[model samples]
Target: MLTDTRNSRYAKLCGTGGKDVRWTNGFWRDAVASCAKSMVPQLEHMFEAKEISHVVENFRICAGEAEGDFDGTFFGDGDFYKWMESELYSAVLLKDPERFQRLRAYISLIGKAQQPDGYLSTKQIIAAMHGESARNKDINEFEVYNMGHLFTSACLYKRMTGEDSFLDIARKAAGYLANLYDQAEKTGNVQTAVCPSHYMGLIELYRTTGDESYLELAEKSIRLRDSVVDGMDDNQDRIPLKEHKKIIGHAVRATYLYAGVADLYAEKGDPDYLRVLHDVWHNMVSTKMYITGGIGALYNGTSPYGNFFKDQKIHQAFGYEYQLPNVTAYNETCASIGLVMWAYRMFLVEPRAEYMDILERAMLNTNLAAVSLDGKRYFYENMLRRAKKLEYELIWPLTRSEYILSYCCPPNLARVIMESAEYAYAVSEDSVYTGMYGENQAHFHLANGADFVMTQTTDYPYDGNIRLQISDIKKDGPVTLMLRIPGWAERAEVTCHGRTETYGKESAGSYLPVALSSLEDAEIVLSIPMKTRNTIANPMVEEDTAQIAIERGPLVFCMEQPDVETESLDQIWLDPSAEYQLRFEQIDGRRIGVLETTAFQRKIWNGNPETDPEGASNLYRTLPKAEFEPVDARMVPYFAWDNRGVGEMRIWMPYRTR
Candidate 1:
């Protein structure tokens, strides 16, 4: 059995209590509010559309308001539960009394929806009543998936509120699942479930209740991925997980599975699991992921779907190895979140800087890009390139809009951003490692049982300067503070008590550890210079061959039609050796970082009859030097693109050879 203990070599949270952390930076605070503003209306619409009401009505059918059959998909209940989780976070952050009361009311309704046997699925209840054939006993129904979210939300709610009402409901639901699985196992007829998110939820339950059964169930779920009945490769159940080297199938499902695998490794200390995980992570980050930390390259490429079918209509799944297409990329918002989830879990296990680097990359570029600036609009599928007046819609099943039918990404992204405080700082025995940087206040305890409060101030992503102040330190020994030196940062510096330590290339991808004995008015300053530079992709990437993308600090920059005077995106080409000026401009009352540089317009090649002289087209003939005209151009953070109305956007641009 894996032990449930902290990593003695690294910093870990002393307990499951909420870190006394709050964002002091207006940039993040405003972004959080923007996401909340977007989420509240979505929640309201879901409420009005009978999304939440369906769950409430299902409970009433046995007794009160709703009757007959259930509405929406079998997996629809997970959406509502996720929304509730996001709303709960928003309520706490904004201190909105009215929103808090309304969510609590919905919690009560959900509680009333549970059955006597701890069964709490509205779809199943309604299906049984209507005599409709729902998903077979063959692990097809998304019941486990829904219950996983419920368990997670319940755990989060309990941690935040110290209230056990929701936790009690979650415990009951998990008990029912445990009993069902145990009975099936005893009969030698276990159903093979596809989604592994429940594995994560079960782990959370183990963390919450110290129950060995939940951990056992989580391990069983991972092993069950090899079970054959009705499972598909798209769900990542094609083979035993230990043998698979590449991350395949649905991007979100694969990430969720690996996340649970990571959690299990942390608790159980399973070396085989860790070995497989590192292999999968290297395969993903090195080849499958996008420059923007996006995944799920193609919805229906020539990848195996089920046991035997190839490209049998799979959505949001990774495509063949390097088949990345900019315009047709299916980088779903949920997949981006899943990427962060997987990376953060890996960081918890090893406390590596690259893990946090990926986490930050996903948060700033792909995930933040999913939501509009006002937070009212959303993008379900993030495209790397957009054409002008192309009448092109997202090739995925959904269209890009302020609202979506699936409605999963909006709330999910909102909640992830709102809870950014939790990821900023992590602590263990005698140290606190700063995984993410932002203006925030966090209270943490050292492994020696000493408590301290820290305030971090920074304009990160926009500016790389960070200052941390420690107060209220009660300690017997010196505590270590580890600051992550992002992989992209060069010439990073950390100053303490007028003593400065500089990190060169060797220390670029690791943490800078500093030990301090006295905590009376101690301050640490870190500076990572933010300079604009051209980044080139690996030559194996045919789409990006001989192309360059602009990057500054932690953000990947892109060219939007609004920022260029040229008519089309393809007409613009940047000089590889030109100097770039970095500055900020006001957009929607916010300062958006923009990079200005000298570029050229690709002069159209009209038939040069005079040069040809033969009045006939020739395959091999010397032509007049291609005419080029210099032009001034600007680029914005990739996340900030598409905000100034829809227009052409491109990240990889043609480089001028001259």
Candidate 2:
């Protein structure tokens, strides 16, 4: 069994038990409130006593007519339990004690409903006693996705609240699953059945409880996933249980499977699992990923099939080809979150800065970009580009699809935001690793009862300068603090007590540490140099045609409609090394930096031949090149784009040379 009794790098960050950062702190508070508000209305409409009785009786009658029998304790639906578990876990992160208590009560109710032999699926109970013909008649398929959710709930309940009740519930469920799998293995009836979601839950249980049995079960499930891969390789008529060749098969499922594999590797320290992880990671990152760190290339079945990342197509409307047509790329928000989760696990296993780098990119851009400023509504699919009508409709590619019912992104975003505090800090035996920097305060207790405090102050993603102050060091032995310098930082300056000192730079993304003994109130300042940089996309994208995107520190910039002062931004061309002015401005009550450049004059032809040989009929760009006095062109935070009234936005603009 994998033992993580050694304190986590995030011990201090999560130990705060109080709100700190906006995304993690404020979002969690709001999720609890929003979910409570929305769920109350939903429950009122869907589950009043009378409504519950009517639905239950109707369901029972339907079952009896179809199979000539009815069974007691075969409740509402298969997936409802999973949804309930997800909500419970989300509530736990929001620190909703009442909801937590309610979930516990429901767990007890469900526990009591289980049979003597621990065979505890609602659908299975109904089907076994009634008849096999009634299995598909209702919504009672033993869903792997639902079981995964319950496992997540169990793990989260333990992590967030230090409660054991949910863990017990998870153990019972896992035992039931183990029994079924054991029987199948003995009888040679293993029919390629595995759920990726359950791996995360089982790993969490193993981490929290240090249980080997769970780890063993997790190993078996990991092996069973070979079926999914086999199915993909064989190109069977139906969707395979597992998919190889990295063909996309259910965005959420695929990510969960990858995540599960990573977690299992972390627990078992199995080199083979790591090999598989690298294979999947390389395949996905190379072919299946978006520039914004989004996944899910094909819209059909949310599967990763072909070369969908070639051009920028915005297919806002969902159909068979929703994944195709560059315009309508369905980068699911949950998939982005899944990427973060996967990257984070990789970081834990390998401790490479690249994993954390990807994690940061996803968090700052794709993941945070999914939610609106108000935190109420969210986009299920994040589109890189937008059409005028699509923008006005406030329509998102995945949200507009029929597949979503109480869609997963909102709650998924909520959980991520609520649990964001846990992602910042990682710890080894004698040292603490700082992965991402934001404004926050954290306190950590060492195993030997020594306490350390870290206070970070910065306006990050906009600025790369970070100030870290450490306090309350009581030991004579050395304690190392490793601070991550981002891959994008061309130069980094570290100072101790206002005096510059030489600290070694690790390979582009690893942490560089400063050692101090018996230190109290020691200050360290890190300055990350930022400059306007020119970057080339992959050569495979287009030959001799390079796109220009702006970079300052680790943050990437975009050209919004307001910045260009035109309805159609495609007409504008940037001069190479244009002497542009960079400055900060306040937009919609938020401060952001902007870049101003020279505009150009153009001729608008109505598909007719020009009369002049050298010069065409007059047409001027919005800001004529000669008239383009250096002006302050504002840029909101990349995460804050489209929050303003909608217009076309481009992160990569065409640059021309005279």
Candidate 3:
């Protein structure tokens, strides 16, 4: 029995109870504003100006056909329903009340276009009701995929607006899908046909509306997915989540499937689902995931097939691997967005700070980097590092001309940014969890009439000093406020009402709590220690096994070729600790730190007499520990790579040993 009261800790964190925290507030505001200003225009440009109209229009036409008559229809250019769902989520979650009117108009039009028998897909309506031969020819093109996205969009709209009209449409559409897959007596097939994207929508519908039928459908969908799991990985054609355990098939589909499974686990609290989720998560994190938390090993099919790392020839220039060939390494932005979406679902289930940690990293680094700073232009594919000017192409399957047209990333990002508030605050019965640090406030209700307020103040990501103040403690009982010690925090110090207490040890992903009871207007201050440290990646990566990356706090640092102003940045070395100095300076109105260190120049090999194997050459095995003269070097956040016109960037660097 959750009440819409403001005194509860959950309420405060959710912003339902008038509590303000810096991290949650800042992130919510920034995300909302960015999505509105950037994503909206892009989405519109795709529909209004770009070549994606055909695909989008075709999807609408097919949906119309499906709804009009019982017979399915396919208009053209494959199924675009998944893209529509992504757009819907982006619109509903991000725009919310502002976009409500437009959404209502669109939904109303859809309802009006519906059929009499509760079936509501444009494709079916066109083919079955109108008996249009042209539209009915390819009706089965992407039926499951389309149904999945439609379901997702409907659920998202209903949850955000609490409107039942959209829900009605959703119910009708779902009923159609359920009959097609679940109603064996009606469809004359015992087999269940499911699309990965639908699971997210169905699970969400169940969660919000508490529909047991939706849950049952979700379970059936999961079973269907399990049935096809083996087909996805048969040929070693996908990216291995572990050694010889590859996660294969279409990138978007694979992540969506995982997302559906995660949602099912959340709804049913099934231990098997949880175990499978863990298996998938572990596999992805260990191998399939990029440093920025993106997945999708192949660029061509946007598929997660093949061992690209082992076969260097399979690695593509754009981080896109079409059939494991190196010519195209286009890491699709949509795939990245999909990864973020899936990871966010994981966060909801586990409520771990790490999931959000990766989410933040992906958003700041890869997600934001996808589009230009101006927001008008966008890149569907993001390379590991930007090289030459890659033109935007309108190739089908791989490329679409719309900025937001059935092109999933734009709208997906929009929705995520809009609903960013939901991610900030998660509540347990006794305490509220703070995942990311930004400036924001929340309000929620408690069972009791007493009201509570929590406020946070800090400039984080740049600095680690956070101050949280609580006001209006209703009851004289012990209350707990949990502050996540980011995986990057080396040292954490907490001050309760000016009484400073230090937590001796710190780790990357853990939480620190401060207890308060009947204390009004009390403040808690957290000071995080930052220092430069050397780190080595997992030994599995071959070339850089001995190399070290510089890190400070939760950020991983990289050295770019431009920073050294050299054709090859292989000669730089860390000088002695005393000699190297870290300096903060303003670049293009942005404040960034630079680390200066000494390096030995590489000697030319002219068949020299001094070709000593043991002698100290230009290539140093270990970096000097002692102080030396400083050299100019720019340092960027590990997450912010590739945003500033990519050059050769290396997180791990070779250094001369002393």
Candidate 4:
């Protein structure tokens, strides 16, 4: 019982707890541990004020502990569940007894709060107690949404600790959901607009228990989305799942629904699902996706042609084909995390290197950037550019505060970062593939059922050099090791047992396959040249046309106000022909590379013509021959922006292409 990557048809890789593979030393291992150590303790304080109180207070409502109103938001219950899941993931690796005790306490309270018939949603239960009309009929209340998180969290907990205390509560709750939705599916009366996210959880329940009814419930939940309601545009269930050629609607909901579709396709191998999955994925990456691997282009912008709701605007949906925005871009952190989830599932089904590329892009940039360096504060909306205004911040500026009203992104980030080791490596029948690079120890079996242990040493995503050593071999036959060739690498080379090989046309954005008959004295050195290069957006994207962004290896770089003259990010333009020097610097506890470039700033001024006629005449006159001044410009990783008290930051800078 281990939490590993499982498609409906295949298991790609076991997680860190599995006997097959373990992480020894790496940037990811340190990141996972550091984030957990900093975050898990603070969560009790963070949630007690809101999320944890909701669950505890709701339990007391039934038990008559005190006369009180229902506490917290409707989705608050899921936040607590996510926090527990993150703690359990960290505890299993660290074997922390104190954390395990805390988990047991939470489970005990949750178990006590459950109704005898297996219903466990705190808000719905309270609504019933208060004699509210149609307590369970309103799907908009997120009844199943909270249940979904509960089911998945319990499944992972059982896998990590072999503990069934919480699993018992989860199973009972899952049974209730199956019965209710199964009946709803039969009558064609289900609510599709409320959200179809519960499909993923039902699949998890089926996977954990091998229950056919649970799988059937998930299938019905997905298929029933074709019954469109009036205001479900945000849910993306407007079209039948099989006919979705392009991704649309709420970005988080869109990716979560697709992840469930991928799960179903893995199990049922439905051609319709597979076709739509590929179609939507291609549509996103080719057009809708930002260069930082972020999705969802617009927030509450109205085009006067956008269809419905009181807001009269499409909220957080992918707008026109190439209408990506910068300052007002609403790349929610949960949406970015959902993209990674969907991509990982696709990778397991098809085993494509391109999927891993997108996964890496999301994990290294927008996803990691959601949390501050101290792991204490969080960002709900990630903006590509932060603009300054004298009265107030133009756009919602990034903050290092721990709490937000819609506190969904922080816990999700914590869990993903803690469990990142599981996404690093994958083992197939006759091959082992490196999904993401980091220094770590991995163990896997060959085609002959013999165990092998390997150690990877590197400072990855910072430097491209990696060394892999086969430390022990139980038995060896024919084996192939696949190394991923990142899309940004100009060149890649591998030296295996003193024989060197260079990358060619066939290797770019693909895997490099190396074959060996035995593992004795096996040491492979892989070096991918990392250099600072300018990035250009699609010419169709009006916001970024003719502007350039910098990227080094897998990291996207931005010009922050602290690193440049104040309010000069927009003034400076980079000379693409000029060479930039890389300098190592310490940011917080991490060592990051900074790029120094010689850039030029053209001076310009415009005044209110009505107020000063002389100023208006001067503006029409020649402006000192439009002199351009040389300025010193520096860039840090885009993820590192907003750490210096944040006045302004821009990723897309004006550039001199010639």
Candidate 5:
């Protein structure tokens, strides 16, 4: 999101900076508050706690400040960079001077670790110290991904703190890349991109510094992919990206690829890039994406297409379309974060409601679910469903872990969570766009040199009512404010300047452009009905054939074992007509909306026919008609699950009608 394209010809909207928006109350405010209090400090401890993560120690050893071997994952350097970036946001949000100073110190240490040539990968640096060969020049060992994080974080550091030390390291690193890629081309060392975060990084470098060479280098990097002699879908290199029709490969790599491409489209407006993005984005949303806006369906599987003889196995990848299996799903948290990034960029380039909807869905659900409510534990893979017993051991823990050996997700989610306020509002030459609804205040400085400050109050997603007050107009005339009418909301109404207009389903998924004039005591308001809706999946999705997923506004609701009366979930039926009681509950000391309703648990006949004279032990029986016994059922937001304790959890369930 720090990839600035506000003035680009193709970018329809520009982001609001820290001075422009602030989350004061409601769900997002609570999430950010939790991140500052629990998530960041805890992560700082864990990263410094060498037993859990040697991320800091690796840097220290590389810089000759400490003595040790490289002791963490190949990508831990990038993970640490992301954490540092998250702290920058936290420091600003809290206005804590000590926090800001700590971040400045960390960045200075990072500067010390950077090599003279601007090359800074801890794994490669530490390996070189022991006379080991540098690993595959940024492709195989993910040096490029680390560089990508470093560049963006450096750019953020420059923006937030006005520091040049980190930025200087990033610039040198960029210079190093420029030389390396040229050398790679001469030596044929460029194979293909793996975890291609560098693409976004290079373009952001161009945006921040206004340098032409970095932008050209980014284009060259994408071009290099077309000439790779041997490629595989495991890294989305099976074919040229422009020719890849469906998104199938490592989820993080694939989404990161698209996100970088989206950033490219925003700057250069390439038709091929836009086409490829649309194709991949459509395929992902309609077929591969989860109901909770999660991506990546397989824990481990081979890419279904390409030269079968040549393509390697795909790990943590998107499986065949509609091959959505709940219990065994592998929706990596970082992949969804990439989705949010890509969707935001796409909306900036094309400005569609669907894109923002996807962005909002992923951010609210899977991104929030990746970390626990307390923000201490984390999930490497976000499985849609969990069971009490299974034939196979969980690929990861059922509940979040305090420390994952592959610790990319926790910090990746952290930075995104800390900066989520940037995603809430956008601006153009004459109008301000409200992208996501939350309780916040906005100071809009339009490209046309007009300025206005707007304040909004809402209990959105829980309740649809929103009120806005505008003040301190600087322009001579009225400016348009484009309010997003989410694709999900129907039967909504808006009131502006004492004129009210109502809309139906036809108006869903489009922006309502409202022109505002200076007023003394007028308020703009919207009331969207946030009824608990029963969401049914397509019949092609076998796991959710007859089941329904519950949603209200933007929140997806799920049932955990502790919230239900029944011991087993196999026979539970949630009646669609059952009136849901909207109740407020304290979760992790935060008041969140919860739904309580009546559900039925089908009786299981487990008795042997001859021995017990009831039914076969198969837990099946033939009756005149299937009947279910009433059971107490309660549902909480999907993001809040697993926090109560690990047990059977479900998003989709059997359905019945009154």
Candidate 6:
């Protein structure tokens, strides 16, 4: 089970494939295969070297296996844990034997580094080695955030391997949190959460061990927010979560907070919480988010605050309604991934296709785009468009780097990639849901406790045809399967057992139920035409007014300066009557879908309209109409644009209807 939400009342989680499903071939398979060969070793080497990361160094120093002070970033421990999770997932996916040995060593180190009281923040442990008490430490140190990841990774270890060596360490750390929360409840000095992921981690721990006290601790963490003083929008602690409505402030924190609340709500089923989540989600998707499924439009922003508050600036933030900027957009890799996490949780609670749509949108585009096709380099912030000149400066520069100073997004994305199969398909005790189309063989247990072997064959995101065959059915009567017709698909047709059924656009953005009476040796074929179409943004979105974007299948297309034969992007315009061609181009050893079309490039104005003279440049001057020249333009999938070399890139282009 991907999330272990099988017992969750509302969630339709990955009910099948618990370290048993095999990914034969597809985007996710390629990613995991590449991750094992490229990313895992590179990241492992860096994390192990003290001069490079200090992640393992701090743990070793605290465990007395090495000598060093705490030199890692505030979130380095959490990132290390993320890498650990990635390795674990990849190992299981590929059946690599060496990974288990590495995991044993790492687990031993973690258990040794933990203090006897179950306290395990390496920063604090190393500090205590130098006689520095953890008390009075700044909340910004993210000690809770670090230990929270420990709980999740530790639980994953136990769930996947049935081993408690690491889980026991997490139990100790969780025990420390129980006492910490108890004392804070008495003292009223609640530690404010920074980039809070602990909420979901605690809930996962509770789910893994079936412990009610861990669940209580998860709720206590949220209740403690009520006592936080001088809270700001950056951390989402200004008011209690119940009263919070608008989703503003740091994008990563906002999404993580929502996901954690969702985990808590899955068990408790709070209606008010659901309402607030829906409202905020509407605000985000309707106003702030990009069409490519990227979140957090602004690299820096001013959150709502009074004069009494000090420094209300938020980083990697979501700006005001319809304030989406293209060239300077800062859709952090982790922020979009966080959106995916939130969307999955929201889908669990309501079982809506809109949430799943966004989940697929973000996961396939920005989330995959975060790292290179080879899975080595990474982008911290994804921009929709970039040119030689930037009118707005970015705090974190936009470019793919081998390893950034923060080093969070690379491993963060690796874990998502390793776990991509979890999002591919979902199952229940009665039926199976085709959430995403990919080529893989899966084992599922349905009603009557019967296990069946199902194989899905498709080249999705580039093609719309999918085939699913079921065999080895022990017991069956009226087998049912649910199909998720995407919000973007105009219509879909499914043929199974010589029966053909067509669904219109009315069924879009929701699930369609198909009942198969003859269940044994059943074969289902789903065909949805992959038509290339020009899409437009809302009229109120100023950056995209009168502009068009290209989309085919589930992939958004962009025109890189290197791909198109145009002198300038702003002067490049698309013809409504233009015919498009689909071509497969080789990129970084991967075949990518490239769209080729004919367009016009307008020449620069030669003279001022009123003056009738050349070189009379003015910001607001009226200029003579420019001449146009026909140009052959080619567009690549938006995710594959930056991989070709750093240059100008454009997602939206000006278009003329006539």
* Candidate 6 lDDT over residue span 215-266, tens digit each: 8999899878878887887888877778877888899889989999888888
Backbone clashes in candidate 1 total: 5
Estimate, for each residue in 439-556, the C-alpha lDDT of model 2 and write its tens digit.
Answer: 6666656544556677777766556777888765555335677778777766678787668854333334767787756456678887775666666565554421455666665555
Best by lDDT: 5
Each model's lDDT comes to: 0.75, 0.55, 0.53, 0.75, 0.84, 0.81
**Which model scores highest in TM-score?**
5
**Pairs of residues clashing in candidate 1:** 2-268, 12-427, 12-428, 377-402, 429-447
Order of candidate numbers by TM-score, starting with the best: 5, 6, 4, 1, 2, 3
| Model 6 / residue 253 / CA error / Å | 0.8
Error of 5 at 491 (Å): 1.5
Q: Cα deviation of 472 in candidate 6 (Å)?
A: 2.7
Candidate 2 wrongly placed segments (more than 4 Å): 1-142, 191-195, 227-230, 233-250, 301-326, 388-406, 447-449, 473-477, 502-507, 542-545, 575-633
All candidates: TM-score: 0.91, 0.75, 0.74, 0.92, 0.96, 0.96
**Model 4 agreement with the true structure over 162-186: per-residue lDDT tens digits:** 7889878888987887777677777
Q: Any runs in candidate 5 off by more than 4 Å, and if so which?
A: 135-138, 519-522, 606-626
Error of 5 at 288 (Å): 0.7
**Candidate 5 clashes between residue pairs 3 or more apart in a chain or in different chains:** none
- Order the candidates by lDDT, highest first: 5, 6, 4, 1, 2, 3
lDDT per residue, candidate 1, 1-658, as tens digits? 0112354222144322343777776567667776677666565575446554454455456343566666655666666777777777777777888887887777787787777777776777676667865533535567787788888888778777778888888889888887877766666555555555677788887877777888898887677556555445677765777887788887888888898888888778878888999998998888888999999988765444344444445568787666677888889889999888888888877888999899989988999888777676788888888866444665453335755666667767877887766678666677888877778888776667768788888888788999999887775447788889888887788999999988886887799988878676789999998877789987777888889988888899999988877768777898989888888887765677789888888765433535645433455666545568889899999888877877889999999767
Q: Residue by residue across 1-658, what tens digits does model 5's lDDT show?
A: 4657776777888788865688889989999999988999999998898888888888888888999888878888888889988898999888899998887778778888888888889999998999988856556687888998888888888877776888888889999889978987887766765778888888888888888898888888887887676677887876887997899989999888888888777878889888898888889999999989999889888888866676478888788889999999899999999898888888888777888889999998999989888889999999889986776787688888888878999999999989988888877778778888899988877777777678889987688898988778665336777778887887789998778999999988988887866534547898888888899998899999989999988999999887876656766899988889889998877787889999988765332235634443336765534568888889999999887776889999989876
Model 4 misplacement above 4 A: 1-7, 10-26, 50-56, 59-67, 193-195, 301-313, 390-397, 446-448, 605-625
